[model samples]
Target: MDSAASEKSIIALDGWLKSPAGIYVREWEQACLDELTANIFGYNAVQVGMPQIDALAANRMPNKWQAATRMSNLDELALAAGNKQIAVALDFAELPFASQSLDLVVMPHVLEFAAEPHQVLREVERVLIPEGQVIICGFNPASLWGVRQGVRRITRSPYLPVAGEFISMPRMKDWLKLLNLGVTRSHFGCYAPPCRSTHWLNRFAFMENAGKRWWPYLGAVYMVHAVKRVKGMTLIGPAWNKKSASASQGVPATNRK
Candidate 1:
C-alpha cells in the first residue's frame, strides 16, 4: 500500500473503533466467534486481537478458549482470566508464538488494519497445527461498505485514508493459497443497508432470512473458514519447483539465496 492509502486506513480504523461502526464490527466479530466455537471443537483455540470477546468466551466456555493480544498490559488480565496465551509483540505480522501450536485461530478484521496482511497470514499459518482452521472476518471491498468508502473518496472526506485497501473475498482466497490454506465455507451477512444502527440490522430476523438467501454477497461484512494444507501436497508442485529452480539457475547462488 502507498503512504496516502495507509494513512487513510489508519484514520478509518481509528474512527471506526471509536464510533458506532465499532459496535457493528464487534457484533459481526461476535457472530464469527460463535461460529468458530461451534465448528472448531478442541482443547486449544486461539483468538488473536479481540480480547473482549475472548474474555466473554472464556467465562462462558472456560475449557476451550484462550485470548492473545499484541498489547502488553492485557497480558496480566488475560492470565488472570486463565488465558496465559498473551503475545506481547507489537507487530502482529510476526507473532512471537511457536509453530503449529494452535488448533484454531480467529482473526477479527485484523487483516484490513495490518501493515502486511500476507505476513500476518503467514504467522497465522505458522502457529496453526496441520488441519487446524482459521476464521477471518473482514469488510468486503465490493459491498455496501465499499461503496460508502468510494463515496467518501469522491467527496474528499478526511474520514478515510488513501492507503486503506478493502480486500475482496476472492483476493483473500488467493492470499490463503499463498499460505497453503483452503477455504471450506464462506457466508456474507449484514445486508440491512449501511445505516448507523448496523448492529441492530443483523438482529432483525426478516433481514437475516432474506439477505442470506437472496442477496448473500451484497453484505457489508463476510466470514471465511479455511483449513491449513499440508506442505508439498499439491498435485503439480514437483514439476513446478523443478521449472522454477531451473529458471533461477542463471543467477548467482548467493544472489538467489
Candidate 2:
C-alpha cells in the first residue's frame, strides 16, 4: 500500500477502535496496565505510541511522558498538555532520550506496526537504566484471532489492521532475552473468538476464565514485563552492623577463655 493508503487505513483503524471489539481490547489492556504499573515506583517513565490510550495513567512516576511517532492532530497534543502529560513526537527506532535515563518504558502495540521492531527494542534497551523495567503489549499470532485473521487474509479481508505483523510470545521472549531483558511477569487475555459484535463476545465471556485455566497461552493478547539485567553488576547493600555481628559471634575468643 502507498503512504496515502496506509494513512487512510490507520484513520479507519482509529474509528474501528471505538467499535465493540476495540472497546473490549482497551478495557482488558487498561486493567492489566493498571495492575502492572500501580506499584512500579520510578522517577522517569514513558508510554510510547497509542496516545489515545494513556497506558501509564496508573503509574505514579514523577515524570511521565507520552511519546508517539506522530500525533494524529493538534487537538490530541492540546489534550495531552491539558492532562499534564508531556508529549513528544519522535521515531521509535531513534528515541531522543539519554542512555540509562528512563526508569520505565511502556510500549503499547508498537512493535507490530513498527518498520523495524528489533531496532525499536534495541532503543528501549539502550534508554533504560540498569534494572529498569519495560512493559510490552502485543497481539499473539497463536490464538483464535490469529486463525481468523489468517482465514480473512486469504480472501483479501483482514480482521486486524493490514499493517500489523503480529508476533508470537516465544519469538518476543527471544528478542528480549537477546538484549538481556529478563522476563519478570507476563499475562495472557482476551479469549473470546474474533467477533465484532458485542453480544456474541459477551456470550463467550466464560471462555476468559476457561481459557486461562485450560489454554492460557492461546489468548489473543499478551503483556510482558521485563527488567534490564546488566552483566556483572551486583547490587550493593549496607555493610553488616559491627555490633550485631559481634553479638551473633559471641564474645571474642580471648574474653570467652
Candidate 3:
C-alpha cells in the first residue's frame, strides 16, 4: 500500500482502538504487558507502533522510546510527551539503533499492519542484545474474532482494521524462531465474541474464564514474550569430571573382585 493509504489505515486503527471492542482488547493486552515486562531488567526499551497503548508502562528501563513509521503519527508524540518518553519516527525494517543495542522491544499490533513483517522482525532481532526480550501483541487468526473478520471481509467491512493481516501463533513463533528469538512465555485472552456493542461484549465476559480453561489457544488476542538466543552459548558450570574420576579410581573394580 501507498504511504497515504497506510497512514489512513493506521489512523483508522487508532479510532477503532477507542471503541468499546477495542477498549476490551486494550485492557487485556495492557494487563498482560504489565505482568510480562515488570521483571525484565533492561537499560533500553522501545515500543514500536500503536502508541495509544503504553506497552512499556511497567518496565523500569532507564531509557525508553515510543517509535512510529512517520512523524505524522501525532498520537505517539503526544503520548510520549505525557509519559516523558523519547519519541522516534523510523522505519521498522531499518531501525536507527545499532546491532545488539536494545535490551527490550515491544510491538503491539505492528507486524500485522507492517508492509514487510519478516524484515521488521529481522530488524528487531538485529537490534536486540543477546538474551534480550521482545514482547508482541497480535490477533489470533484461529479465534471467533478471526472467523468474524473473515466473514466480514466478504461484505467488505472487516471487523478489524482492513490493513491488518492477523498472524497465527504458530506462524508468529516460526518467524521468531528463524531469528533465534525463543518464545519464553505466552498468553491468550479476550475470549468474548466479536461484538461491536458494549452491552453484548459485557454479556460475554463470562466466556473469558471458560475459554481460558477449555479453549485457551482460541482467544481473540495473544501476547508473546520471546528472548534472543545466541548460537553456541552455554552457561559455565562447576567441573565435576575430575572429582568423579578420582573417586572412581579409589574404588575396587567389580570384575576383579
Candidate 4:
C-alpha cells in the first residue's frame, strides 16, 4: 500500500524470521546458498534483501556486499564485517549500479515480498553483466507451506507477511526468459511441514529425500539459478573480403607490374 505499511510488514517479517519455523527456513536456505554459490566464479557479488540470511558467506568472491530495503542498524552490517564491507540500503525496484557491473547477484526472498516483482527482476537484469549469474530463493507456492498460507488466507490472522504474492516456478521461469536470462538449474529444500515445534520438524526430517524424489518441485522453498545473455555480439578481426581486399592480397601485384 504505502511506504509506512510496507515498513510495518517488514518489521513483522523480521520478527517471524527469529521463530523456530523461520530458523528452519534459514538453515535450509543457508545450505542451499552455500552449495549453489561455492563454485560460482565472480568478482563483485551482491545479495539483495533478507538481512537475516548471510547470503554471501559461502561465496568466495572478493567483493561481497549485502543490499537491504531496511535494517535495524546501518552500521550493524559493517561492524559484523571484519573489513570494509557493509550493507547498502537499496530499493529492489531501483538499484544504483552501472549496467553490467555486477558479476553475480543473489536475491533471497525478494521478489515474492515486493510490490512489483517484475520491476525488481528487471533491475536485477540491468545490473548483472552478460552471462552473470543470479541466484533467487523463494517459497514454492505448491508446497505444504503454501497450503498453510492458503488456509490462512481464509482466516483473517495470517503469519509472516502472508499478504505477499508468492510466485510459482513456471511463472518465474517465464519472467527470466523474458529478461533474456537462461535457466541454469534449481534446488528444492525445506521439505518438512511448516511446524513451529523443533520436535515435529525433526520427526518429519525423513520427508526431505522423499519429497525430493517424489515431488521435487513441491518443496517448501526453491532456489533458481539463471545466467544473463546478450545477443548479436561477435569479435571482429580485420575485414577480409576477397572482392574488395587488395591490402592483404600479394602486396598489390598490379601496382608492382
Expressed as tens digits, the lDDT of each residue in 207-241 for candidate 4 is 99999899898998898899998898665798679
What TM-score would you give candidate 3 relative to the actual structure? 0.87
- TM-scores, all models, native as reference: 0.72, 0.89, 0.87, 0.85
* Candidate that beats the other on lDDT, 1 or 2, i.e. the better one: 2
Whole-model lDDT for model 4 versus the true structure? 0.80
For model 4, what is the alpha-carbon lDDT of residue 78?
Answer: 57
Clashes of each: 6, 0, 0, 0
- The lDDT per prediction is 0.66, 0.83, 0.85, 0.80
lDDT of 2 at 76: 67
Error (Å) of candidate 3 at residue 245 is: 15
Candidate 4: misplaced stretches above 4 Å?
Answer: 70-72, 79-84, 155-160, 234-257
Candidate 1 residue pairs in backbone clash? 4-163, 5-162, 5-163, 5-164, 6-163, 8-161
lDDT of 1: 0.66
With a 3 Å backbone cut-off (N, CA, C), the pairs that clash in candidate 4 are: none
The sequence of per-residue lDDT tens digits that candidate 1 reaches over residues 1-257 is: 64344434655564565555566556666766675556455556666554545523622323344443333346455654454345555566666667987777777666876677888898999988888888887778777667877788577653323455668999999999888899998878766555555455445537756877888888778888899999665554434677778888879878866
Candidate 1, residue 116: Cα displacement in angstroms equals 0.9
Error of 1 at 159 (Å): 7.0
| Winner of 1 and 3 under TM-score | 3
Model 4 is weakest, by summed lDDT over 10 consecutive residues, at 80-89
Please provide, for model 2 over 15-88, each residue's C-alpha lDDT reduced to its tens digit, 9 standing for 90 to 100: 76788877888889989999999999979998887665778878888898777545357576558534536555
